[model samples]
Target: MFSPEGPGLRELAVQALSSVERGYDLLAPKFDHTPFRTPDAVLDAVAAALTRMGPFGNGLDLCCGTGAGTVVPARVCRDSVTGVDFSAGMLAVARRRALPAGPRVHWVRADARALPFAPVFDLVVSFGAFGHFLPRELPGLFAQVRSVLRPGGRFAFPLVAPPRPGSPAYWALLGFDAVMRVRNAVWRPPFVMYYRTFRPSDVRRELTRAGFRVELHALPEFGRRRDGSPRVRLVVARRPAR
Candidate 1:
């Protein structure tokens, strides 16, 4: 699932052996060419959905590697837009891009678990970065998002449905997780990425605990699964307005 411009097998092997932040630093230049980057289609769908939900001001993109989803907020938010990540390398790559003519764009290097911001953002969006966090970390991560948002502001992201049980996709993810678990058990500074850790129920509950009113909006552009469930959904969790 990697293009020729992406990291090669030897480079990927070296990255896999490094810590998550360092691995991403090494992969930053070629990340967009890999399947690891959030897809443009997903970003477009979220942007359209947010356009309906907003006329927001001062947006933040949490874990915004390479700034793929930064454009979404720059379109919907009236004020400035900030993209935050722990990887300086990723932020450097993002800073090189010519942003659209809308809100002013700022790239900051910060970890999502402990963001260095006030409760100033009216909207926050994150894409394809949750798998980097473990289940226990969700409470703190969601809390961090809530802390940075203004009352009634939303923290949104797309959540794809889990692959069908016994299907090739399902087995592939399961196998990937199994491999990761084993690797972490033996490796130092564990690379914590898993496909199955974030479930809808668990996420909703965690969002609620984090003081967000959680809701889901089906993304029809991705179509429905055989079980009649939306294949892709936008998880829009808003901090309650006082």
Candidate 2:
């Protein structure tokens, strides 16, 4: 689903064929018009949830493509905020957008696995970026986040419940992943984005091993599932204060 201003099918096909960085570069200008961008509703909901638990000093948005989730930290942090991503194109687009009235915002182009920063941030948040990381990379990825956070700092992100097996959504995601696998097998510089790899249980265990005390908070915006579990949850993983 995309707006008229979004990339055309031909443009999308070209992007899909390019490396992930270059593909995002081609799409950055029209990213906000595409479904690929994180929605404002989700951002607002995350902001609300974070606001309840914060008055943080400084914040970082890890893998902050187009800075959609940067607003969450800008709302909750007191001093300064930074948005980091590997794509210069995306960072350029993010830099052009006017930020809300909050902390000073800076954009940096850097890989998430090897962030260039001190452990000085009080809060770190990411949205819609986990799919880029494979399951095997979770430990190093979580460690990178932990390394950039101050003692007692938090690394927060929202997770939606996976679609039930046999559901249409389930089939759709499975098919998407299958297609991606086949595409990567035949393509150069694989574009890694999988919808089903980031399970909560596995993530929690990895976060724990990364030295974070993890907690889950229900986001009331999405309500509950039939099984009484929250449809959406904010995973708040804190670095030890000591």
Q: Estimate each model's TM-score.
A: 0.98, 0.98
lDDT tens string, model 2, 135-197? 999999999999999999999999999999999999999999999999999999899889999
Model 2 has an lDDT value of: 0.93
RMSD of 2: 0.7
TM-score of model 2 vs. true structure: 0.98
CA-lDDT, candidates in order: 0.93, 0.93
In candidate 2, stretches whose alpha carbon ends up further than 4 angstroms from where it belongs are none
Model 1: per-residue Cα lDDT over 123-234, one tens digit each: 9999999999999999999999999999999999999998889999999999999999998999998998999999989999999998999999999899998789999999
- Candidate 2 colliding pairs: none
Model 1, residue 187: displacement in angstroms? 1.1
Local error of candidate 2 at residue 214 (angstroms): 0.4
